[model samples]
Target chain A: MTNKLAKLIFYLGTLISLVLFLALTFDTHRQIQTLTHADQLSEQVVAGKRVWHKYNCNDCHTILGFGSYYGPDMTKVYWRRGSEGIKAVIRSPEKFTTWRKMPRLPLTDKELEDLVAFLQWTSEIDTQGWPPQDQKLRGAPGRAVTLGVSPGAVLFQEKGCFACHRLYGTGGQQGPELTHVGSRLSYETIEKVLTDPRSTNPQATMPPPMVSHEERDRLAAFLAGMK
Target chain B: MLLAYSSQRVAYPYFLVALLLFLLQVVVGTWLALSYAVTMPQWLVDILPFSTTRAIHTNLLVLWLLLGFMGTTYFMIPEETEREIFSPLLAYLQLTLLVGTGVTAIVGFLLGWTKGKPLLEIPFPLDYLVVAGALIFLFNVGMTVIQAKQWTLIQGSLFGGLVFLAVMYLFNLPFYANLSIDWYYWWWVIHLWVEGAWELVAAALTAWILIKITNVPRELVEKWLYVELGLFLFTGIAGTGHHYYWLGAPKYWLWVGGFFSALEPLPILLMVLDAWHYIRNRRAGLNGRLIFTLAVGMSILHFVGAGFWGFAHTLPQINYYTHGSQVTVAHGHLAFFGAYVLLNIMSFYYAMPRLEGLAEFDERRGTLAFWWMSITMMLMTLAFSVAGVLQTYVERVMGLGYMTAQAQMRFWFAILVVLGLSLLGGVILTVVDLLTLRPALAGAKKA
Candidate 1:
């Protein structure tokens, strides 16, 4: 292409990208509005919202693609997992996978019911076919995944965790000397503690479980075998 | 061994004070990171105390960086301007006022005396003092440049940075709002000053240090200077889109923010390549190899650590998920500390001993400080970035609440602890080296 034509094409491309990005952002905004309106939501769903914020749910999960993206997009979670499967997982996340685990949070029955309603409500929304590809099970079924090695390592690096905890005698000093925790704790125990460590230890001050089962398992095993 | 020269040795006391403050700031930042590693407080859900810690960490970073920058600028402007300072007395007074006022403001913030803006959290009254200090600095550097009439690119660059900073700061102050347009103007200063004007200042200092140490051609340095400035202006202004992504602002910001931020790395890339090229050409001619190496290394970091990683989150789409998460922290950690503060430290290594007539000072100590600082920060940046991305996954994508996400993120915090300790080791070594080298270099010949 001639320089002028190439320049024109580049500008056109830039303009198109800009337009598309704005459209996506607007869609996100719309989703947020839909998520926030309480009149249409059930009391259980409202109570679940309270639980989400009280625990700072945005710390781990993205709803409508706007919060966190650690475990799964919980927006359509109920539909994906199905209500019965989700309730079962909620009852005992450890039973779902031997390798992957989530903290069994101590939610009251009402809270659990509300949380289920919230998840169900979330799953019913029009997500414009998100999940572009299935991240869970990595587009395959029944893979007992631990942490993927280097990506997990890269995740460790990217998260600034290396600033504090040492794996195999490397990193920072402000937290529990995690030089040997992997061998100390099973993936189940690790998942249990990570989800809500206050239940495990009242004085434990570690932040709430902020990662997904896969990431947790990946990081857990990485640290677990650190001898 | 005293050679006749106009410059006097910068008092060791200034560095001593700067070091102590830096140590304190690092401790706070470490604590803040720990807070992130765990959960937010349940009871004191008030933004007051946590906000104070945030302000303190951010403000101290700005102050110390400024102190170091100003000290370097004071030494550099005179040399580049070819004149003595217009008023050394005023410079001292300005320093005292800034340190005093800054400490008071932070104290006030902790005591619930803030306007409650995220970055512009300092109460309205104290801002006047900051402006006063900035103006005095501008006058000192500005008059020196004018008097010399031999305005080099470095001087032009610093002057440009200072001028823009003043204008932006003034524009950010909202005199009327109860909340004072807290978040809006916060970006004016935070987004504009740090990413916008600071790049100009950092590039200017980096190029000047390279020129002085390597005695590289001024023409080449000046050309790089313009390219840096152009890139800074283009990306810096447009980069405001990143901040607007979540602030209930215009949707068009995503496009503007992403595209501009993506381009933000260009100047840094150019800077890194040019520095390498300059060093490769001048290595045989350069005498003080350590300073040359530090200056060049600083440039490369400006690109890879700051520029490349910054581009990773420049898009509003990415930022939509990443905003206020560990990912943002990752970018901020690298860009602010890696590119900007590291570059300032490079300036100090290049100019401090020379301006102080301690050219033969223990290059070993300086070299150690250089490596310790670089390695510690590099590791820290890598950790923060990794932690941030992981944190994003746990917190944003995973459907875990903030507290829950933080619990999982403790793994990353473990890494931060390691980096913190490394930084601690580095800081201690820096202090020791600075102390030992001072007395040792006391008797060295002035060039």
Candidate 2:
């Protein structure tokens, strides 16, 4: 082939590629803008992403499994820590100095709010059901509980058992550690404790289970299998 | 070093600086590999962590390769244009500014002053210095061509590529408020550099080397050069879509990124074919030496690593499994070493003999170094590939925990540590050979 024709072919290929790039660039921008409309994230959430970038939190932590492995994954921290725990941990990470510490950030309360909102938004993205739920099993060992499959497991944390009740004997002194509650409480007794909590203990600070009968049964089954 | 022309001496500083940076990268890189293999102490890790190690390694590679390209262009430009350098003083000043700024940035990273983006880690102040240096280089080269009575395809493409490189850096200066937008431009810089501009530079450099060292006619090499450049432009520009697949971008990127990136391997394949032909039908004198051998080795090795291995994961389906896995690391190691590192080394090897009138090049050390470095790197790539595949399967597929998945990858990391040390040994040998070689009384034979 002649040199001129080769140059022409080169230009042709580049032009085609350029045309694709221009079209894709526009399409991608439009798609992302559209996502924001249907997406649950508010303006505050995106500003929270900016706060995450400002500190370059990714230097130590990962979101969606793309950053350093030093810090815990923040994707499900909203679910893991809840709104209160996330605020407490980042407000003073030095407080949780027992295992795998995170450094404290000098964020204002507003910044903290934004960062949490951003993390919450990230968790909502359809990660095609990533993190495989085993990551959420971080609290208890050998439970093999898939939270999505067993809504009761989600209820366990959402009800704030993690704040006071330890699954493997590693929680607060406010409540009895429930690691082997299966051995300790039968389904009838466990249900009675939730429905008529004073029957199990007169000094019980636990609220009665307010969920539907089926949900109560599921949570009972989840707590019963502890043994 | 006996000088033939003023422009020829310019490559020495670049090749030597690249040698130093290469040595640094290997040392830090090996330390990083060992850290992964064993449990590093927290206190020590507190001072120098894995993230810092990676940041330093990638940044140094970027710096030295940039310097190498600038230096190689200086050497090739004058020869290709058949003219002297526009201003020797400007050339030296450009090198000093770039190297000084680059070294400062690396040192600053040690002190924890960085922007924290991998590969785009040059801090705010140093970024400006880099821009100035690139502009100076462009001005000097642009002037050299302006004054020349003649110019060729190689010179034009190289200048065009350098201009693109400098212009691309401009996008990186803006701080996008949106994380998605930040990711969008970040890929523009990284993707465009490796797949876009560097392709042009590599093709031109390959053409220049083939014309000088082999019996290939200038016109034939230039023609193939255009074809390669054409492929690079097509696959490279559109290839940025591959990065958008997971960055929370629109859904159409899955098709755009995957299809174009799959085609990215074609240019490298063309390069391999061209080199094979050059080696097979070349003049006997140019067939066996260190410089010619590197030219051939790097060309084919680049295709194998960057082309073949890159295509392996460019598909969205596969990338979903391997996005941040060690499989990505595997491709990173092989692709960067083969495409940029070896490309610079090839420029050094072929340029010195012709320009400095050196004889008796380090054939033995070069060959031994080739075997050690190339073989060890390939092994490391294989190791990372295995580790990555396992990590993906266990972590993503089986729904195993991260620690459990990492535990399985430990065995591969151990293999990588051993292979990394071996690669370092070969690198040291190459550095020593380049630094101290005995030049024979007579000059190298012409092709």
Candidate 3:
């Protein structure tokens, strides 16, 4: 009777071991699939990474919740700007004529393209609408935003608008208010104002033509809807 | 050879230089503050030379503090290590390099070779040389520690403080073309070195000075020293978080920045409490100007003013408005002047009598200068804080532009200018007391 009992216990232990092995194999297969789920980065994106690392860009400027807090966040840079506009700005920082100036570095064409690619990847990474401050023109008759775009809004944040301009009730007072910019100007006029902002007034302190066409339209619409 | 009495020989020269530097810093700083009030007066602008003056004010504060520290370290290291300083010649060389590099950097800044960065404003290649000088000093001190078998807790704190100061400085490199990035890392170097590491050194220095000067028990002083260092390490790391409140960081940082920064005062409080405990128990009747007392008091004030101001704006909600405003200047003034500068002054007093083998000097003069300087600095900080608040309300909250706000607050700015002049007067008085008056011991030595 004792011999029979021993044989039954041995058989049960073997069965349990086989079942555990099968379960481990299944779990390993699932982990492998999950690990491969992320898409492979293209060559352009890889090149951009090289430039970013070489410059130690991450040491100061944060992107997509990475890098240091020493400079302005660049996560939404691409969404706010297009490829050609960013290219121009990178080539000649004269595009960004503001009080807070970024010194022009001697970057090669290849390096600039890679940096832009990095910026492009940054702009698309779902920030959940961060840094969403608006721009308002003081004492303007109307606002100019229309067509589901907020040109003035984009203009405010992008131009470091808060540095000199204020929305509804906040920001520096060095410049005029722009809350009513959309109502005061048509889309084409807004475009003209953007290209040569000083054309409206010779002594105007405003900088000229920093936005691309699509961004200008979108930003104008956002401002128009502000009312 | 240990300077049993040779310290007296070096006393007058150091005091003279330190006093002159102090007075010059105060005058320049006051003039600059007044210019903001007076709408940038042409004569004042030309005389003060804003760009160069700013550099001088900051650099003088740094240099004087360093001179004091080195002088004290030269005396204290050998005593604690139970051996003479590794090389007195090297010590002098380090001082020469520091002064030489410092003068060149200041001149370069005036010529507009400024990296346009504060604190780390020196042109690129020179910065490396400064680092090299620091390494040489570190080597001398490190070798001295190894030769001496006596490695006390105080020595450990001092060594740790120096190492961290050097490490903090290494990160001040210009990795980005953006000036803001440069400023950010500059503060990391300056703030961490002064606010953080300096506090640790202060605790160690206070313990050693008190033990030597008074009847305080060595064991008790050592115990408090460890306690103070604990507080420093806990708060210092988190204290640097205050500088991160702005600079386009994520909002979540407000939690770490604000909460941890609030604790920065604890170490300083411990320092003050420990000093008081020692004084209370001592039987020496506290001879001389009680310079150590003033040093401890100033260190505590540093914690209150710099650390508190840091807490005030560290919250994202608050920093979003106060960033780059005069409130920052208020904090800067108190933190740098109140803590490190005052401690240096006190250290000078302690070392001066000992080095010169002079009789105890009049405590009344030092006590008076201490009170005058501390009070005036506190008042100046208050003025800046008030002006800063008004600026924030008018410029940010009220949605007025920068020019309009500046135009509106011309009167307050004028008052600040006048207040700044008073601060300069305080500096003059302190320098006079420190430099001109010799104790009876000096006469005895000459006789």
* Model number with the top lDDT: 2
How far out, in Å, is residue B34 in model 2? 1.7
lDDT of candidate 3 over A114-218, digit per residue (tens): 778766654543222333321133211133233223445545454444454445654445456656666777766666666677777777765554567776766
Q: For candidate 2, lDDT tens digit of each residue in B1-447?
A: 444467768878878888899899999888777877787755665566566667787788888888888888888887777778898788899889988988888787776667766577787888998999999999999998989857788888888898988898988887765556666888788889889888788888878878777867877788888899998998889888888776667777889889989998888988988988986777646534677678778987898889999999989888876776778788888998889888887877676555656645546776688878998999999999999899889876775445567778888888988998898999999888777765643333322
RMSD values for the candidates in order, in angstroms, are 13.4, 6.6, 12.5
Model 1, A223: alpha-carbon shift in Å?
Answer: 44
> Which candidate number would show the highest DockQ if scored against the true structure?
2
TM-score of chain A of each: 0.41, 0.55, 0.49
TM-score of each: 0.65, 0.83, 0.70
> Order of all candidates by TM-score, from best down to worst?
2, 3, 1
Q: Higher TM-score: candidate 1 or 3?
A: 3
TM-score of 3: 0.70
Off by over 4 Å in 2: A36-51, A54-56, A59-114, A125-227, B1-3, B354-356, B440-447
lDDT string for model 3 (B1-447, tens) is: 225534224334545566676777788777666555554433433333454556666777776676677667766776677666777677677777877887797777555455444445566788887888788878988898878867887888788888888888887754543222334466668767876677767767777878876778787777666656655655555455555444433333356556656777766776677777776677675554456667567757877676677667766577666665667678877877767777777777777656655556756666776777788778878877887787677765764544455555556667777777777777777777666556645443222
* Reference-based lDDT, residue A152, model 2: 70
Query: Of 1 and 2, which scores higher on DockQ?
Result: 2
In angstroms, the error of model 2 at B159 is 1.1
